[model samples]
Target: LAKTTQPISMDSYEGQEVNITCSHNNIATNDYITWYQQFPSQGPRFIIQGYKTKVTNEVASLFIPADRKSSTLSLPRVSLSDTAVYYCLVGDHGGDTGRRALTFGSGTRLQVQP
Candidate 1:
């Protein structure tokens, strides 16, 4: 299984933009980069996913370079409520085997202040 790297913690003020970068040196071309955010005891929630280039939704944006070795998760404007643990996951989104699995490593704890 491939692994993703992220900081242990990040701090940001309210109304600030926070960009967290995750590195996956051994990421495969067939794999997709997915991000999930977890708050306190809750389970991780999907933020975004991309294979190449850029993908954006109502929550966040995912940016993958040409090499696919690394990706960035960008949060537009963060608030105190946005404080949570961010996870970078790399895996095959699906396969013809009729099964889909995604594993998330220990997450990056994000702290948002007033």
Candidate 2:
């Protein structure tokens, strides 16, 4: 398991693009980078995941470098509703082992202003 570091907080206005970067210095070969967003008193929602290169979905885009040390979560046209705690997790989720589970950190609080 690798420890991840993210911003403590971030601020953005409505309809602006926001990019949150997470650093994982000890990432493994079987590891995958996953991003999640959580609201107050709620479970984290899966946003995106990538093994390497880039991955894009309707919600967000994940960019990973060839070194596999860090990743960035890009949210386009964010609104106030997108404001929440974003978590960057790295693990191998292939089977039903304990590695499938995600460890939640303090997360980066995203504050979307009007």
Candidate 3:
């Protein structure tokens, strides 16, 4: 298991871009970095993921450097609705392990102002 660290809080205005970076120095070989976004009372939604290099989706883009020790999630033109908590998780989810639950910590609280 890899331990991840991210910002505690971030402030951004509407129509601006926001980028949150996370560091995981002890990532294992089978570990995959994943990002999630959470609103006030809702569960964290999967944003993006990458084993290496870059991966993009409708919501955000994930950028991983060659060292594979860090990752960044970029949210373009963020709106007030985007204000939420962002979490960076590293692990593997699948197979007959029969365990699928997100262990969340104090994630980065992104405040989007109008």
Evaluation by TM-score, superior candidate among 1 and 3:
1
The 10-residue segment of model 2 with minimum total lDDT is: 93-102
Query: How well does candidate 1 match the true structure, expressed as C-alpha RMSD?
Result: 1.1
For model 2, the superposed segments whose C-alpha errors exceed 4 Å read 94-99
lDDT of 1 by residue, 1-114 (tens): 478899999999999999999999999767988899898889888888889999999999998889888899999999999999999999985668847777778878999999
lDDT value for candidate 2? 0.93
What's the C-alpha lDDT at position 2 in model 1? Answer: 74
Q: Count the clashes in each prediction.
A: 0, 0, 0
What's the lDDT of the predicted structure labeled candidate 3? 0.88
Q: What is the lDDT of every predicted structure here?
A: 0.89, 0.93, 0.88
Tell me how far the alpha carbon of residue 67 in candidate 3 is from the true structure, in angstroms, after superposition.
0.8
The number of the candidate with the highest lDDT is 2
Prediction 1 TM-score vs. true: 0.94
Q: What RMSD value applies to candidate 2?
A: 1.6
**Models sorted by lDDT, best on top:** 2, 1, 3
TM-score (all chains, Cα) for each model: 0.94, 0.93, 0.90
The positional error of residue 6 in candidate 1, measured at the CA in angstroms, is: 0.7
